[model samples]
Target: MSSGTSNGEHRYVIIGNGIAGTTAAEHIRKADGAASIKLLTNEPHPLYNRIALPPFLKQKIARQKVTIHNEAWHAERNIDLMLEQTAVRVDPLAREVYLASGATLPYDTLLIATGGRANPLPNANGLQNVFNFQTLDDSLAILAQIERSESAVVIGGSYISYELTEAFRSRGLQTTWLMRGPRFLRRVLEAEGGALVDRIAGRHGVQVIHGVEIAEVRGQDGKVSEVVTSDGRVFPCQLLGVGVGITRNVDFLAGSGIETSSAVLTDQCLRSNVPGVFAAGDSAEYYDPYVGHPILMGTWDNATNHGKIVAQNMLGGEVPYDDVPTYSTTLFHNRIMAFGATPESNPDVEAVMWLDEASESYRRLFFQGERMVGGVIIGQRKGFPKLIDLIKQRTPIPVAEREQVLAQSVQ
Candidate 1:
């Protein structure tokens, strides 16, 4: 039947209870006090900080520190929290959402913040040791295995895989990191930065294997023991972590009217082509005015902004979503941050590099003609704020003055 709320203060149904969905629910309540708001999530937990998950996975922090909102928090707000349920399909014409349990939920407004799912090995079957480090349960399970395991094979060279590689090596496990590319984050990291990452990984006890893909996952006693590469190299391991990235959680909207380009396509206002339908979080490719293009960014800051913008638009307010995307994390005893464009986005941008001793620390700033378009800062962040402002303001720096700018930036 149609359970869209008969009391009639306009029902809002949100899918996925991550940062984006939960934040949207909060803003919706603040905007309309009496509106019926219900949140549905496939995860049992209400809301937890996924950004801090790396440390949690490494067992550096207690599990309780990762959880932000609990069951009681949702109860006090009078928001219907449907846990362990997923949206199987969406009927835009009927304004109804169907769950796998065969229940139907009608809504006056719908937000598809389903985000993405962990992409796994192509031929991975029912195996006990292969794991993807995304959710809390996945992290907990990996930690438990880490406590007993002595060797780990991490596949994929993205940030997720590196985090796993760091954790395994830090815990004194014999770790081997495999990647399909010659370098980690090549699209984002400059050649020097990429080389630095390889150097750092090697120095930290991780055997960094480049330009290889796993062709087979062989197991003994139903647990993964070795992976054979496409080139016919076999690596033995007691545990495996795959970080091939995420598959956008938009497959359910295939027949729906919502347009999707790698993710749900939206304008600067976070509005989909279908009226009363909106998308946020990792699945929303909304316009980013700061970058002068429509881009999809999966970051804590991006999702947080999307929630506030969609909430305002859903309440009949006109506002534009603008942000300069950046991601910061510590890697192998070095602190690094990347802002603005990557090679995939701005391949031809001119660069200015400033390197420190041991080739271990440096910052590379990218520019398009006169305007700053991108940057990568390592081992130093005192100059990041000014550099980011230059990007936002489209400030032009003379070619001759670029070197002096970096020199004075740290001073």
Candidate 2:
């Protein structure tokens, strides 16, 4: 056995360096002090708060403040972090992970916390100022481009596109927000909330175009200049921000005995069908005890809590992960939050919504029968805690009184 391992100790290997993987490593060290832990990531930097990248990209905060756990912090925790190491393949039979550098790591228990990669626009070949806003590096490159570029085109109606729009607009760029949807956040937000986002974009001089596809990216002197939409509408832009969505990174798990779908399938305890192997974070489609179904949550708190629950289960604890996943973000000027299952997530659930058009504030509460299932809140955040509690406790509020309940809380 390697000197890192002892007779009674087992080697634990974790892939990826996001909050989920890093949090699991920290908890495992505290729970099983003697277990050998190895953490690997393609990123050179230590675990950082990716959620803070919005303000970082906007230049509202310094780069130093975005970092969470540093190298020395991981060292003090005794986590053997292998930076810039890419896992090329996994062998379930031999229980080994083959690195791109021709190295192999053997593990008794493995956690594939490998997250998702930002989906890119088609035909965006090596174009200058075209970026998918996801990582710190992507944000840094975008910030550098904003220093010289103006009049940018943002694609997609997702959160990343809004963040890119916010960053570019804050930098005094003439921004044009384009998407193939009717309004912003078409999949999650109700009509009032989405229209409020469009209004927010318009308030800042952002041209919000919907139901259009990118036909071509025209360049001038080897640099981006304008974009041609499929509808033949041409918009002049110097930068292109693509935030279509993310493709979960699970290609390395093929033939590794790990079942896969849109994400890695895990039970209520976050365990894979494969013994001694597990998955978490954005790539994990864990069975939700609250909803009584499998769900893929890509929120910071859900992933962080997944780390703790998975670690406990990895160490033989029967702790099931449970929480009403909430993803909160800002679009231009509106603070948008989605808690539990929205109408898009569960269309069968009934919805009660109130729109304060004067204030541009919107609140939506989703219910199943008499029990609160989930909700989406836009502009107002003060009553989010109560909505979450209603979902968690499955509070029974009659459909007739649903609006009254939401009204009282917001009031």
Which candidate tops lDDT? 2
The deviation in Å at residue 24 for candidate 1 is 0.8
Model 2 steric clash pairs: none
After superposing candidate 1 on the true structure, give the runs of residues whose Cα lies further than 4 Å from its correct spot. 1-6, 344-350, 397-411
What residue runs in model 2 are displaced by over 4 Å at the alpha carbon?
1-6
Candidate lDDT (C-alpha), each: 0.84, 0.85
lDDT per residue as tens, model 2, 1-411:
233355668799999989999999999999877888999999888998999999998899999999998899988989999999999888877888999999999988889898899998987766788899888899888889898886889999888898988888898999888989988778667667778888888998888998998999988887888899989999888899999989888888888879989889999989999888889899898997656677777789888998988888877778888888888888667788888876565667777888898877888887788888778777767777877888788777987899898898788
Residue 382, candidate 2: how far off, in angstroms?
3.4
Candidate 1 lDDT for residue 406: 72
